[model samples]
Structures are given as structure tokens and as C-alpha cells.
Target: MTYCVGLLLNEGMVLLSDTRTNAGLDNIATYRKMFTFEKPGERVIVIMTAGSLSVTQTTIARLREAIDDKDSTPDQSIMLAPTMLKVAEIIGNALASVRLDIESKMEASKVSTSASMIVAGQRRGGGMRMFLVYPEGNFIEATEDTPFLQIGEHKYGKPILDRVARMDMSLDEARKAMLLSMDSTLRSNLSVGMPLDLVIIHKDDCQISERRRIEKGDPDFSRMSEMWSEALRDGFTKIQI
Candidate 1:
């Protein structure tokens, strides 16, 4: 299990993902769940994945291969796709293909191969867009009505987003919301351990504005988490109901 979340706001976008992957209580390890591709002033793409590690890793590998292939077309490579929508399609198709291939080989074992991804990016002349791509090559875009997308062990972290996320929030606020969301997931679920990966991309920049990796016991994150816990406790005490 894992947790990854992305927010698309009027000012920019913020993304976060945990690095822990576990096969069992005794077999936990860290593998980055966030990946980025960029063409600096032309385009930028960020993908956060969850579910079967085999499927997600293979899909990402194939996508990179397509980008490097001399014969690749827009339909076959996300970097060559003309629109964010088309990029989502390319990623979805790749994920579905990889999942199916892995599942077939694991059929005799009856192991599951389900996976999903949050695809977010901007083209030089196009609008910023975000999509939650499912295992079957279908996807849903983020809109004003729903300015955020999440995958993996998301339930524990969704309430804060529901209450405070806004399409007009500043980049700083978006980062805070994203971090708080991840903080919540970490406290509630052991499967979603840290060393987190965070990315920020400002509107129309077509490139990553900031990136950071928060390792376990990071001072700033620890302070923020402590502050949030205290504030919540204070609010709980003040509630008349």
C-alpha cells in the first residue's frame, strides 16, 4: 500500500508521495512512487503511482523507452502527445498493457495486478490539467468542482482536502494541504511510511518550480505535524457539541 496526492490550483500544482512498499510485515522497503518528465520551457509531466509495484515499474520503464525511441509517435509517447488529455491516454494505455501482461504471467498463481496513477502536467501553450487514470485505461480529469486527485491508501487523508482545498489557494497553501494530507495518512497507516517526495510547479512555467525529499525525522515536517496535532486537539476541546 501507498499514498500519493496531487492538487491543481489557480496558481499552481502540488504533489506528494510516500516511498514505502511492503510485501509483508517483515518485508518493507522504499521505492519512489513519484516520477517526472520535462522539456523545460515546453512541457512538464509528473506521474504518481500506486498498486502492484511490478506493473507500475514496468509501465514507467516502457514509457521512458517510448520517449527515447526514434520511431515513437504522439500516440505512443507522452512527451510527444499534443495535449494533456492525450498524455493521459498514452499513460493509461501503457499502464493497462503492462498490467495485463503481468497478470497473464501470474494467472496460475491467481495473484492480482491492479494499479492506478495520478497524471498531472502542463504544455507550453495549453492549460494545466490533472487526471486519475484507472487500471483499465480509463481516466477522470480534475475540475474546479474537484481540484485534487489521490490514489492508493487515500481514505485516511481525504478529509482535510475536502475541508480546506481550493482552486484559488496559493502555492504555499497547496503545499501545506498536501503535506498535511500525507501526514494524516502516515499516522493512520503503517503501510504508508516516509521519506516523502514533493514537487511544485507554478502555473504556465512548464517546468518544476521546486522539489524536495522529506526523509523520516525531518525537522520541519515533524514541527508541522506536531502543530497540527495540537491545533486539532484544541479545536476538539472548544467544540460545544
Candidate 2:
């Protein structure tokens, strides 16, 4: 249980994920959920995951292995994939394959190994794209009608996105929206916790333009959270009901 979200706006893309994983109340630990693969100006891809750690970790490892394999073809390696759609397909296949293999071994134990990911990136000479990859290897792309995608403990933060996300919003606004959305989830969910990873990639840059790790008690995030709470209370007072 974690929360990961990505916004695809006209200006660029903004991705955020929490770094918390817990097997039980006493077994909580922090493990980064965001992974990035970049070739600077030629291409860049960011993957934010949620669900079984084993599944996500193995899926990512396999992707990296494919990229590093000298014999890998354009279809076999995400870095060389001609389009973002192909990249998503490659990831989907890997995720599905890994998940099936793990599930087969863990079947008798009845342990859950489900996982999902949000993939976002751009390749040189192409427009940016984002997709939400399902646990079964299928995915749905973010389009103009829905410029954002979310995974994990997403319900707690989806309201703001539904009301405010837009295809034309600036990257700065998207960043604020993403933080506020995560803040909402942090307050409502115990499974999702601190040291959030955030990344911003400007359209056509084919690289991570900016990145930040917002740890627990970070002054700026704390202040923003407090201000948001206060604003909500003030707004509540103004309501006629």
C-alpha cells in the first residue's frame, strides 16, 4: 500500500510517489517507489510503482537488464523502443511475466503478489505520453480528456485531481497540485508515509528537468500542509450549510 500519481500536462509531466512499505504495524520500512531511466536528450522514462515490492522490483530489474543487454533489439529494450506505446507494451509484458512466475511459486502459500505502475516519459522528436500499467500487463494512456493517472491509495487524493487537472496547466501548477494531492493521502492513509519522490520533465526535454525528495517534517511541505488544512477549515466556515 502506497500512493503514486502522475500528471500529464501540455507543458510537461509531474510524477510523485511515497516511499513506505509495511508488512504489519511493526514492520514498516521506507523504500523508494520512483524509478527513472534516462538517456539525457534522446529519451527519458519514469516509473512509479505501488503494490507487491517483489513484483515491482523484479519487473524493474528485468527492464534494466534488457536495456543493458547488447543483443537486445528495439522491441526488446525500452530505451530503443521507437515510441512510448511500445515501451509501455514491453513493460506490461515484463510485469505480467514476472507476476505470473512469482504467483505460481507463491500459490500454495496463498500470499498476494499484485502490483501496478504508472509510466511516463518522452523520447526525442516525439510528444510526451503517460500510461497506467495494470497488474495484468494491460495499460490505459492518459489523454486530453483525462490528463492524470493515479495508483495505490489513490482514493484519498483523487477528488482534487478530478476537479482541477487540465491538459493546459503549467508544470508549476501541476507540481502544486501533485503535492496537495499527496498531502491529502498522507493525512488519510497510514500505509503511505514520508520521503516522497517527485520529478518533473519538461516536454521534449527527454530528461528529468527537476527532482526532489520531500522527507518527513520538511519545512516547506509541512507549512503547505498546515496552510491547506487551515484553508479547508476556513472554507468550511464560509459554507452556507
Candidate 3:
């Protein structure tokens, strides 16, 4: 399992995902969960995945194959999709197809092959959009009422987002909120480990504006985690019943 979150605000979008996959106590490993497709200033798409690695990897692989196919069309390639909604549809279709293809084989072996993704991006001349794609090919868009999408081990980190995230927050603020949210999850879940990938897409840029990889024991993240723990403790002490 893993923890991934994306924030869609008026400014742009912020995405973060952990790189951990644990099959068992002794089978833990790190595999990046964030994938990006972009054409410089023309368009940018970020996909952060959680669940079965086979499903997510195949879905992404097939999407890339379509993009690089010599005969790829606007409807077939996400980079050339006319709108962000089309981009999500293309991804949703790919994910659903991959999951169905693998589900039967896995069922024969008594294992599960299920996965989900958070898709966020912008096309030239279009506004930024974000969606949480379900395992069955359907998805829900992030709206003003709920400017965020989360997948995987999310319950531990959702409170901060519910209380603090806003549509008007700056990109920097959004990034901090994501890190703090991840910190909360990292403390509570063993399945979600370190080496986080973060991506920021500035509205209308149609490309990734910034990206960061936070590895285990990174001083800055460690410090922030410590500070957050202290702050929480202080807040707990200040409250009176």
C-alpha cells in the first residue's frame, strides 16, 4: 500500500506520492508511484497511483505506448487530448481495461489485482483539472467544494486537509500542506514508507513547474515532521475541556 494526495487550487496543482510497496514484512520495496506526461508548454499530466503495481504499471505503459505510437491520434494520445476531461477519460479507460485484463488471472491464483489513480493536469488554453479515477474506470472531478483528491492510506492525513486546505492557497502553501499530511500518514502506517515524489504544475503552463523527491532521513522533511509533532502536542496541551 501507499499514500498519495493531490491538491487543486486556483493557482495550480500540487501532487505527492510515496514510493513504498510492501508485499509482506520481508518483501518491502520502493517503487515510484508518480508518473508524468508533458509536452513542454503544450500540456502536462501527472498521475499518482496506489494499489496493485501490475495494474498501475500496465495502464501507464499502455498510455505511453499510445502516445509514442506513430499513428496515435488526438483521441488516442493523452498529450494531444483536446481538454483535461478527455485526458481523464483516456486514462480511466486505460486503467479499467488493464484491471479487467489482469483480474481474472490473479483471481485464479487467489490474489487481487486492483488499483486506482489520481489524474491532474492542464492543456494549453484550458484550466487545470483533477480527478480521482476509480478502479472501475469511473472518476469524480475535484471541485471548488472539494479541492483535493487522495488515494491509498489517506485516513490518517485527511483531517489537516479538511481543516486547512483552500481553493485560494498559494502553491507553496499547498506543498507544505501535502508534506504535513504525508508526515501524519508516515507516522501511523507502516505500509507507506519514505522517498516521496512531489510535483507542482502552474496553471496554464502545461508543464511541470517544479518537482521534488524526499528520501528517507532528509533533513528538511525530518525537521518539519518533528516540528509538526511538537505543534500538535502543544495544541493538545492548550485545549481545555
The candidate maximizing lDDT is: 1
Better TM-score candidate (2, 3): 2
**Predictions ranked by lDDT, top down?**
1, 2, 3
True lDDT of residue 28, candidate 1:
99
Candidate 2 Cα misplacement greater than 4 A, ranges: none
Q: Write the per-residue lDDT of candidate 1 for residues 58-177, one digit (tens) a residue.
A: 999999999999899999989999999999999999999999999989999877799999999999999999999999989999999999999999999999999999999999998999
Q: Write the per-residue lDDT of candidate 3 for residues 1-241, one digit (tens) a residue.
A: 9999999999899999999997767999999999999889988999999999989999999999999998999888997789989999999999999999999777768677879999999888889999999999899999999998999999999999999999899999999999999999999999999999999998888899999999899999999999998999999999999
Candidate 2 C-alpha error for residue 204, in Å: 0.9
Model 2 agreement with the true structure over 131-156: per-residue lDDT tens digits? 99999999999999999999999999
The TM-score that candidate 2 achieves is 0.98
Q: Candidate 2's error at 16, in angstroms?
A: 0.4
TM-scores vs. true structure, each candidate: 0.98, 0.98, 0.98
C-alpha lDDT of residue 172 in model 3: 92
Model 2 global lDDT (CA atoms, 0 to 1):
0.95
Model 1 misplaced stretches (Cα beyond 4 Å): none
Best of the two (1, 3) by lDDT: 1
